[model samples]
Target chain A: MDTTWSAIFTEMGWGMVTMVLNLLKVLIPLMVGIELLLHYKVVERIAPRLGWLCRLLGVGPKTIIPLLVGLLLGVTYGAGAIAEINRRTPLSKRDMALLGFFLFGCHGIIETTYLFWVAGASALFVSVLRLLIAVLVTAAAARFFRLAETRKE
Target chain B: MNAFTKVIVDGILRGLKTALMLLRVMIPVYLCVTVLKHTAFFGVLAGAAGPAMRIFGLPGDAVVPVVTGIFTDEYGIVAAMSGFAFDKAAITTIAMITLCFHSIPVETLVTRQIGMPAWKMTVYRLALAIATGVFTGWLAGWCF
Candidate 1:
């Protein structure tokens, strides 16, 4: 019983340390990059070009940074991007919620799909299904919100 | 050069602050999961959620990895599932569920920081994940 308790504590300690370290390693570099990009107005230049994606997700053009970051990176990193962007140029509540829904369902697509593929699952199947589900659900929610707004008006 | 240096410093500081905030969620959840794994409670949970696997057309054993994935992360799902022998369809179904739902506690906190309420985001993801899992199950069975 005592050994089991010690083992549990040890595992917890190690897990927390590793998790935090991993988060910092990726997050610090990512935050620096975003800051540099924003400082140079790179995001502004890129945001307009992603109009098609903005339309597809039914969000504003300014959301392209966070949306792409969240899709390619992971949820936590995406949230970082969202918060930073929101601080700079406020996103509508609707846009934030839509992004939350989309990313929470399917962030880190390539890495995740690749991991699963290496684990023996079909790469095409997992990646396609995950993206499809996230896109469909987010698009449906956006449509619902639009209809509700029109009804109110 | 001076402005660039300031931006770099600001970014690092912000990153550190955010990392600290995240640790507030990650540490406790990690401890809880570790403790749970050391007890019979983990297996009990697997058993309880086992029946629900049928909804996704997954086997009972898939619950172990699915539940682990929810509390932990994608790596946890793979690690837990290493002991099992799941078919292609089952693997795909499980992947669908975990992809949508993994790292629930930490990710929910991250979303909560960005103006979405924690409970609302959690519920939304859980519902969407289950729905996707079920759909993937049916689709996988038909296709593969």
Candidate 2:
């Protein structure tokens, strides 16, 4: 215990501060860019292409920006987009639950890429596996949410 | 506000709010992971978690990355993973796990605001991460 405490002070203390700084370096800029995109309502233009997939995912057009943002960027950014949707056009509980499942297995493209690069991980394996899991879980969630909704009705 | 002005101001305010909210979770978790690494508990954890990680073809120390990735971000996991000589297959599996489950603290907060249960999102991500890790681990074993 004494050695651990001393080690924390002498070594891990500096490591903690540096790691947090490293996180801010990546996250802050991403958040700011996402906020600006939201302010400009980029989703309005970008989401049209998501039409075909929307029905399949059980999410409406409103969920596109958030879902894509989370899939392509970070979940925090996606959450911001989803919050915007709730403020404007609320999603059904089923859709919201469905989205939770999709974002679970897939979020943050760059983070995944960086992990692959730094950790000697294979890009293809991670990408394919995550996409597979995301689609499967999302499909199951949609089915379950739909069944629950029907029962409620 | 003019269109140009609105974009800048809204971004600044919204970004600050989002960053602060994220920091609330990120900072504490970062500190906890960092401090834990300095303690003996990390080794004990690695010992216990080794078997589960072996299911993904990873060594026991890989637990640090898995735990860090779940709670924090890529950097934490990267920092945790840097020293080890993890093979290509183990790295791939770990990457999938981190991509799926990293930043649970902030992401769950976001989900709750979007009208889902935070715990549900966390559970969903974790389950999927595990599934994918297993899948990739198997793939790695088969291919190489």
Candidate 3:
């Protein structure tokens, strides 16, 4: 309410429209490519190599590319691809939560570098520490879930 | 439709639907933030959130980047910190928390798209960010 009519229209109207359009431009292709990947069986091939690692994290092998891609491409562009994987795969609730842990902490190498520069923080320290924490937390979660499973059994 | 054509159309439709779902969260929150930036509400918020910030050893003003980063992206925190002279400890502290938790509204929706509950995901990020920040802050305060 404190914002002037002009500010609201400019920031909310055209601004939001542009953001939505830009997001779609990246997301649509990623989503479509995910479908294409399924058709091509790309995920099936790569997923096998990630077997033990994925199990250690308690996530589906299908989550590997999205987690890796999220690290490299950043979460914004990777979100559609990740959501596509979740839709196609029968990942468990704990696996989804673990994926959330992996992606949220260590996403986007470039974004991290840029913010590191702006914040004048150490890149090695920030990125390495984050990756370490992600692995530890996800491993801990996986261990917790496995304990819960054993208890149920 | 052919199999290939079906894939294309279905993917496009699914993508569009996902984008729309995310936009529902982004648009209103973005507008609200734009409005808040122009009001005194932000200052009051910074003050209200300041005590919680000491665990990370950052000053009250660092709250700006933390909140901005939560709602937006790493770039948002970068932009907020551009004007400040926070030392390396504070900078690293802020970076850890924001790195874990940035882009909350939109990312929360995307996480929800993957079937994680939004509130739980948000809480996970926030709690982890703070715990990490506090630990790192304590470590940094000792080292530097």
After superposing candidate 1 on the true structure, give the runs of residues whose Cα lies further than 4 Å from its correct spot: A1-47, B1-48
DockQ score of each predicted structure, in the order shown: 0.43, 0.41, 0.39
Tens-place lDDT digits, model 3, residues B5-93: 99998889877987787666656556655666556887887688789888788887788778878777664565455445689888888
Tell me the lDDT of model 3 at A74: 73
Q: Worst lDDT window (10 residues) for model 2 chain B?
A: B22-31
How do the residues B1-144 of candidate 2 rate in per-residue lDDT, one tens digit apiece?
887666666655764665566556555655566677655787999899989888988888788778777666666566666545677877777887777778777667766767898896787677777777787888887876
Candidate maximizing lDDT: 1
Interface RMSD of each: 6.7, 5.1, 7.7
lDDT of each residue in A1-153, candidate 1, tens digit only: 898888767766665665666667655766686678668877457767887877888988777888877786566667888889878888988988888888887887755776676566878877776787778888899999999999999
Instruction: Chain B TM-score per candidate, please.
Output: 0.66, 0.68, 0.66
| DockQ of predicted candidate 3 | 0.39
True contacts kept of each: 0.71, 0.60, 0.67
Model 2 off-target regions past 4 Å?
A1-43, A148-153, B1-45
Candidate 2: CAPRI quality band: acceptable
Error of 3 at A145 (Å): 0.6
- lDDT against the true structure, each candidate: 0.76, 0.71, 0.73
List TM-scores for all candidates, in order. 0.71, 0.71, 0.67
